[model samples]
Target chain A: MENMHLDQHISKQFNTDLEKLRTAVLEMGGLVEGQLADAVKAIETGSMRLAEKVQETEDEVNQYEVNIDAQCTEVLARRQPAASDLRLVLIVSKAIRDLERVGDESSKIARMAIELSDEETDPDGFVELRHMSSNVQKMLNAALDAFARFDVPAALKVMREDKHVDREYKSAIREMVTMMMEDPRSISRVLNVIWSLRALERIGDHARNIAEHVIYLVRGTDVRHISIKEIEKQLDQDQ
Target chain B: MENMHLDQHISKQFNTDLEKLRTAVLEMGGLVEGQLADAVKAIETGSMRLAEKVQETEDEVNQYEVNIDAQCTEVLARRQPAASDLRLVLIVSKAIRDLERVGDESSKIARMAIELSDEETDPDGFVELRHMSSNVQKMLNAALDAFARFDVPAALKVMREDKHVDREYKSAIREMVTMMMEDPRSISRVLNVIWSLRALERIGDHARNIAEHVIYLVRGTDVRHISIKEIEKQLDQDQ
Candidate 1:
């Protein structure tokens, strides 16, 4: 009976630990997603206030990262999880890194927004750059959803979306350079827009990283820099 | 007798493992340093050949990074080191990350050099930026020396040198912007220089990261983003 009671206590503790870890990661994901949204909105609407808010929220995101790191260390020390649990811990560890990079991209966009305050006019800045932001925002939202649901298909969709962001980013850079060539006065403002778009593209990559981690967590394989068809084939072969 | 034999085996294995890690790191360091120097020369002398060499060298650096990562894992699994050893292993992991980032910066500079061929300006075009690159190269060299000697003072000296890089980086941005404004047609060529300097600033930062890891590994304390005086006080207090 004593042994049975002790086993019950340990099992309960392990479940609680798992739950805590899951909640922590989700909370971090939610905060980072919110920051990404704010960053997009800041650049989309040219809202310096929104940019300031995103900058402020970075502190909270950093704090969450620190807390999650502490929690991972504590859980590893206390429970000594094996196999699946160990894999979960490692996935979370790697996910935190991706999430932190996302936070960096957000702050970088906010910085561009702040720099945008001195801007005047680029002919099609909004139509071109904000369009790219929308695509990147979609990728981020999908990545976060896949992370929440552990949906491999949704994760794959996000990975596919990154190309659109990258395409738009390069196009935007070329367009901005031409604009600066045509009018030197537009240099700073156009550069600011180009920088924000680049940041958005980087944020899209970070989202893809999260999706890749989600795929790895569910499938025990990495899908980085690989096509979805290749990943699916590998998954099928694994079975 | 068994315990003594075990100790002898452990010591022998530790020596071999440390040697492998050190050599890999030194090799990566040397390769990245050469890449950066070649990248700057390519930019200065308009040598696509030099740029191509830097690109080819980056592959070797990437391979070194992969090998170091596996070695770190194998070492960790074989010898569950404690305290100082643990610190050393973690610091090496972080240093590897820094080296990889430096490789990335070198590649970026090389790419800029490749792009420069299409828009070659007067040879006087990159004087300021070339000086910035030289400063970055010097810092990187000193940082590697600091790592080799485990000299905290030398590492601190490298940290203090980041200010000069930053100062040059900021002034170069201003000068580049002015040049673009003065001649709108020059925007494309000047943007490449701006990007190259930005890459150099980032490479210097990676060197700083390596220096900080060195300080942490030897002292068991994180000195990142903190002042040299604080690091000195910590070391003094420790002794």
Candidate 2:
């Protein structure tokens, strides 16, 4: 009876550790989301202050990743967690990496915003940038939510949305090329806008990667390097 | 005595698994290097055959990542390695992610080569592309070599080289912008070259990332999100 009670106590402690790790990851995700939103708004409003704020927040995001990574290592070392618990720790490790990269893309966008704040803005590229930004922001939010809930269906939706985001990115690049060709003098400025658009597109890719991690976490399937259609078919077959 | 022999046998098996994982990663690194070389050559010589070969190799590269990742997980689950052994598994996990990304960048460069094969060649951008390509390729090779030997000094050198690559990338972009402004008609073709240059620059960044992983593995310190100077100081203090 005493052994059984000790086992229960240990199990409860382990659950608390896992719960805390999850909360830390979500907190990090929230920080990255806010940084991305500020970056986009800075670009739209040409607010150097907001862009600088994003830069400051970047350090915080990095610290979160480092801290979360340590927690994961501690859990793995102490618990030697098996099966689902092992998967959770591994998934958190990979997801934080994606989140850190999303933070990087956000910082790149913010830098572009700062560069364009002094230069004459090109309205054409911003139309595409703004559109793409909104799409990626939603995708990232949904991806984080899916992770929080282990919602495979929501993750699948985010993966499907990535394809559309890729198409939007290609069309936006084409439009930028045409704009640069029409006004050669605007080449440098338009190039910066193109970079901002590129950053946004990459953010979408990172979000898709997070969504894939979520699917892997919940379904115990590796969904990377496969098409959304294939992933969906596999999930359907599993059912 | 029977139990002692059993322990020895299990330890030997674990060593074999770790050895196999390391060799697989090196093989994957070698494949990615070939793809990058082929992609660069295809751009320089306009060889659609070589570009297609690179595309074919990408699937193989992706498969290597999946295989290595599974091996890492198996080791972690079975061995529950602590201290240095645990760090080795984690480093391999993170390094493979960087390797997979390098493969993606190589594939992107190959795609740019295919696009440029049809268009009229622009010699100016190719000069910078070739220069950046050679530098990144060397950095990647050095990084992998460092990982194979667990050589921290070699890894540090690769990290230092990354800064030069970034500077070169910036200057190349500046030059490309000038060429586009001078010959607006060449904008489309030159843009493809710019993309290839960007891909090469990103490859250098990934190489640096791999080098950082190597440093972390050897030193048991997280060297990410820190400047090279800071990393050096930290290592010096430890010594």
Candidate 3:
């Protein structure tokens, strides 16, 4: 009976540890989301101050990754968690990396914002940029929500959203290429916009990766490098 | 005495597992290197067949990542490795991700090669592409060598080389932009070259990431998001 009591206590403590880790990851996700939003705003509004703020927040975002990684290592070493607990740890670890990369893409967008602010604002790609940013932001938010709720269906939706984002990205690039050819003088300035749009597209990719991690966590299936159609088929069969 | 023998057998098995994991990562690394080289060759020589071959190998590279990831997870769950062993598993998990991304970048370059082959071959940016690809490839090779040997100094050197690659990438982009401005008709073709150069530069970044993982595995330090000078300072202090 004493041993049983001890085991219960240890297991409860382990659960608390995992919960804390999940909370930390969510906090990191929130921070990255804000950075991305600020970056897009900086570009749209030509706010140097906002862009600089986004750049300055990069170190803080990186620190979160380092801290969470250490916490994960501690939990793995101390608890040796298995099954779902193990999956949770692995998911958190991989998700934080994707979040950190989103932070990086945000920083790149912020840098582009700074460069664009230096030049005469060319409205060639702003519409595309704004449209794509909104879509990506929604995708990221939905991905995090799915992660929090362990919603496999929501994650699958995010994956589908990624394909939409890719199409949007290609169309934007095509439009920009035509614009650059039409007006050679706008080439340099439009290039900055192109880069920013590229960064936003990459952020969407990271969000899709996060969604994939969530599906893997819930289903214990490796969904990476697989088609969304195939993933959907597998999930439906599992259900 | 019987328990001690069992302990010895388990420890031996754990060691063997770690060895196998390391070997697998190297194999994956080697495959990615081949893919990258072929992609570069396809671009330089305008070989559509080589580019197609590179695309076909991408699935193989992704499969390697999945297999190695599963092996790492299995080792962690079964052995519950602590200290250095735990670090090894973590490093392997992360390094394979970088490797898989490198493969993705290679595929992107190969696609560009196919596109350029269809267009009139403009010799504007191929020189920079070749130079940057070779540098990035060397960086990746050195990083993998460092990982295989656990050589911190070699890893540090790879990180430094990454900075050099970045400089080359920037100069290449500047040159391409100038060429595009001078010959607006060449804008579309030059853009493809620019994208390939960007992919190579990103590959350098991933190589630097792999080197950072190697350093973390050996020194038990988190060297990410830190300046190279800072990393060197920390290493000197440790020594």
- Highest DockQ model number: 3
Which pairs, if any, clash in model 3?
none
Supply candidate 3's per-residue lDDT for B75: 91
- Between candidates 1 and 2, name the one with more favorable lDDT: 2
How much lDDT does candidate 2 score? 0.88
Alpha-carbon DockQ of candidate 2: 0.75
Q: Write the per-residue lDDT of candidate 2 for residues A1-239, one digit (tens) a residue.
A: 00001123358889888888889989999999999999999999999999999999988999999899989999999999876677788989999999999999999999999988888545558899989999999999999998888888888999999999999999999999999989888888888899999998998998998888888777778889998889889988887
Per-residue CA lDDT of model 3 for B24-140, tens digit only, reads 999999999999999999998989998999899999999999999899889989999988789989989999999999999999999999989888655788889988898999999
Q: For every candidate, what share of the true interface contacts is present?
A: 0.38, 0.72, 0.69
C-alpha lDDT of residue A37 in model 3: 95
Two-way TM-score contest, 1 vs 2, winner: 2
Q: Which CAPRI quality tier does the interface of model 1 achieve?
A: acceptable
TM for every model, in the order presented, reads 0.84, 0.95, 0.95
Please write out the lDDT profile of model 2 over residues B1-239, one tens digit for every residue: 00001123357888787788888989999999999999999999989999999999988998999889988888999999876678888989888999999989888989988988888544668889989999999999999998888888899999999999999999999899889989999888988889999999999999998999888777888988999999999988888
What are the chain A TM-scores of the candidates, in order?
Answer: 0.89, 0.94, 0.95
**Models sorted by TM-score, best on top:** 3, 2, 1
Show model 3 residue runs off by greater than 4 Å: A1-10, B1-10
By DockQ, the candidates rank as 3, 2, 1
Tens-digit lDDT track of model 1 for B143-233: 8888776777788889889877989898988888888888777778888888888889989988887888777667766675357777788
In model 1, the runs with Cα more than 4 Å from the true position are A1-22, A70-91, A120-124, A145-156, A212-236, B1-11, B123-125, B223-239
